[model samples]
Target: MASDLKVHSFEEVAKHNKTKDCWLIISGQVYNVTSFMDDHPGGDEVLLAATGKDATNDFEDVGHSDSAREMMEKYLIGEIDGSTVPQKRAYIPPQKAPYNPDKTSEFVIRILQFLVPLLILGLAFAVRHYTKKE
Candidate 1:
């Protein structure tokens, strides 16, 4: 770290976000990328969208080349106050609810399918028996 590198709070860095005045924080380093917006292969929108938050993941996810990494030096303005940036949340698997056979619609449908045909046959037999001559 250069002794000349100034430190900026997250809130302070966030306010510079705009097409003509954008800034980004990646890996705790603050960069003034306003001038580089038009030249960015990803376009200004990509850089603009990265503002107002820690963009380390966004930056790393792209797998920037060594030349791209070297190019970042020209845009480097300062270092961000790490304490103010939000930490990335760890992945937590969702809890699975136990399967309840009694609550399933498939169970009700199966019961109805079996009973409906039996009920129709019983009704038809009852009608035939009642209508027969004594």
Candidate 2:
């Protein structure tokens, strides 16, 4: 890491939020994306929506292409001071009872899974029979 690279607090990064001065933090790196807004393939609103905040999840969720990743390099301005980066809470999915095939809903869905296809096939056959030449 270059010692000269600017380090900004989250508050400092947040100060640049505007159409003409947008900045965002992603994975603790700060970027001034104001110039890139008009050129963003997703449109300026998408970029603007993430301005002044940590957009790491939103950015990663889009699954940006390698070229897009490369493009971001040009806008790199600094990194967020490690101490200032907000710690995100870990998500824990709610526990549920183990799946039971014997459940009525599951039994009904299994029955429908089998019968719906059979019914569709039967309907197709009946339609064909009725439409056949005399």
Candidate 3:
């Protein structure tokens, strides 16, 4: 059940499928997240967790989380299960203009942490400009 609310255990997640670019069928449906395995922000660990298993709970667990789910949406494209498999659309990195803060705070925090020194340097420059006497 893609909409199931019950969270799957980590062990269950790990048993799903670990293969780098393989698709798994569950309950007559196909979920083609294989191409996204290497591109996942958390790296291969997240994709490995959902291999070879019914990943409804895993989807809930990750999407329920702020950052994980937000990141997950970037890779989602409806259900890809069955003989009517959708065309393999080229992966397009979604560009969000003005950079929405709707992304997970953890990602935001990581970015901010990386930028803090530059921010401080800018502030120092500003302070020096304002305080210098003629």
Candidate 4:
């Protein structure tokens, strides 16, 4: 059955990205969804945006219904050549932000925000006390 399906390269599928001739690669299968664009519930723009790349993740993320999945069979033109498509990179945890002097200074400013007001009040009290004695 695999022999019966035409195999398309990533580049070949990318060429049909326009509104008039849209195609998509989902789960390694190439689909010429031009006819279904207007009928697509998500709208044709969603399909257009998904072009020029492997949209397997985008397609699956939407959690399409079984009926939608079945409908795709009608548009199935071929399978994408795995060798021609770039392999997705493994997920990498984000790195912590580097130590920032600005952040340290911000902390100091916050502490001063409270302490400065308290210090001024204390100084005023000290002056009042001396003036009362005079």
lDDT, each prediction: 0.93, 0.88, 0.56, 0.94
Which segments of candidate 4 are over 4 A away from where they belong? Answer: 89-134
Candidate 2: list runs displaced more than 4 Å.
87-134
Worst 10 residues of 4 by lDDT: 125-134
Per-residue lDDT of candidate 2, residues 33-91 (tens digit): 99987888899899889976689999999999998898888888888987876677899
Worst 10 residues of 2 by lDDT: 1-10
Tens-digit per-residue lDDT, 30-126, candidate 3: 4446777676666777656656555556656554567754555444433433334333479899886776566677798889998999999999999
- Candidate 2's displacement at residue 85, Å, is 3.0
Who is ahead in TM-score, 1 or 2? 1
lDDT of each residue in 1-134, candidate 1, tens digit only: 66799999999999999998999999989999999999999999999889999999899999999999999999999999989887779999999999987779888999999999999999999999999998
Q: Between prediction 1 and prediction 3, which has the larger lDDT?
A: 1
- Order the candidate numbers by TM-score, best to worst: 1, 4, 2, 3
Candidate 4 TM-score, C-alpha based? 0.66
Clash list (residue pairs), candidate 1: none
Flag clash pairs in model 4: none
lDDT of 4 by residue, 1-134 (tens): 55789999999999999889999999989999999989898999999999999999999999999999999999998999999998779999999999999999999999999999999999999999989953
Alpha-carbon shift of residue 91 in model 1 (angstroms): 2.1
